[model samples]
Target: RLSNVLKRFARRHPDVALTLRTATSAEVSDLIRRGEATIGLRYDRDRSRDLDCEVLFAEPLGVVCAPDHPLAGRRVGKLADLRDERWIAFPEVPGRREITASHVFALFLTHGLGEVAWTPVDSLTAQKRLVEAGLGIALLSQSNAAEELGSSRIATIRVGDLAASHEVVAVTRHGGFLSAASRRLLDILRADFTKARGTNASRRNGVRRA
Candidate 1:
């Protein structure tokens, strides 16, 4: 999504010298805090006092499975319904370190779930591939996997009693000024996010009705 936003910005400001840096979420926050980067994008629900953040969008984050999984086409009534199921999880522990924090694990704890059975992987694509191979169910951002869900290669498992979700935030140093170029880029990003959010909401509603 950041790539999409940058493409538009580059087309309009062809002469602007733009540098793109990719890093772990912790590193991105640090870059903004130290004034190394004017803006950064991160996905998480946590708030930081050292930076100002504009929420791009927040949507239900849920489980997903391969099309052949027994629960693929089913809507679960509670988290406990799948407590014994295996998961594809991140290779980190929540609250141990900011860089290693796992929002998925935090969600599990929030639901009073005990230690879960999982296979850890650091790559999102790899995790999804594992799910496609029927290794285990994985946590997924509904909007991120729209294409797969639409094609029926993957199915979202919505828990009726769970309200877990995360937000994508545009962040910059607190009380800092954004250059005219950065401000223009942010405006474009916000507009694009609004359009995407509406589309995602419609898709979610349609799936529920089916």
Candidate 2:
């Protein structure tokens, strides 16, 4: 979504130089607080006084697996069938602030199937690659796996009782200077990010429904 916003932002201000930085959710906050980056986008909101957070959108996370995986195109209704599948995800610790790790298991624990087989991989790229290789399945947002999902290389595995999403928020240093370019980019984000993410979600859901 930010990429799309940047495309337009760039067109409007060709003189501006835009550099994007990537990091974990926790790292993003730290970067903003230390003035390493003028604008930061991260999952979930932070409560500290060093930054101001505004939610851009929620990216829905669901069961994603290889196209040929047994559960790829099925509507899963029970926890029993999912208990034994190999899960590739971030290790989840209850009551912790995690961007991508916790969504995969909360539903399992809620349904009384606390024991699950999972491998922890810190990188989202590695997790997706593992799932695509048929090594394991993962709980992931569509945006994170857009390329794979769009090309039919990966597919969504829907659980009847599952609902999980992480909010993508725009973060900036509190009482910090905002450049015209920065403010304009933020304006683009504020104006169009939801529609962009919403369209992506609809397209993915349509594919799943079909």
Candidate 3:
């Protein structure tokens, strides 16, 4: 989503050197903490104490399944309603934060559903493929599954009590110096998110971030 904005920034600042790296949120936070990167953007709340975080947006998440699945198109009112359903799990990388998995488990625990069943898949694409094959449902960000939902390839199963979401944030070392270019990029990101929030509020009666 920020691809266009990044391209524009590069074009506008031809003399400035920019390097983009994609990694897990934990790894990104570590890079910034160690002075390897000036700034980082990621999903989920940062647990690192050495960085400052600015939440840019909140993305709603939902249970998703193949269009032909039994629970497809259904709004689950309780987590218990899904206790018997099989799930496609995202493998938790050791020593790293697994926000989605943790959130899903927490929701289950809240409703007294103990140790739900799942088949683990490490890759997001593979997980989606498994869901497409009607293997199992998976929890996913609505935005990430928008295309599939629109095409009827998959459907979001809304759990009334499951208000699952993640905050997208820009992070920087708490006590570190931010180069002028990094500050400028961060400013552009904040401005872009502000504009998005206003546009969303007008169209949806709420800001993009909940």
Which candidate number has the best lDDT? 2
lDDT value for model 1? 0.77
TM-scores, all candidates, are 0.75, 0.86, 0.80
lDDT-better candidate, 1 vs 3: 3
Tens-digit lDDT string for candidate 3 (54-137) = 998776678999888777888878878888888887667764544445556778998778877888777777878889989888
Task: Order the numbered candidates by TM-score, best leading.
Answer: 2, 3, 1
Worst 10 residues of 2 by lDDT: 93-102
User: Against the unseen true structure, what C-alpha lDDT does each candidate score?
Assistant: 0.77, 0.81, 0.79
Per-residue lDDT for 1-210 in model 2, tens only? 667788999999999999998887788899999999999988889888889999998777778899999888788887557889988887654423453344556677777777677888878888888898999988887678888899988888888777677888899999999999999889889889777666768775884333
Model 2 ranges off by over 4 Å: 92-101, 196-210
Point out where model 3 deviates above 4 Å.
93-95, 150-152, 197-210
Q: TM-score for model 3? A: 0.80
Query: What C-alpha lDDT, on a 0 to 100 scale, does residue 52 get in candidate 2?
Result: 99
What is candidate 1's CA lDDT for residue 117? 80
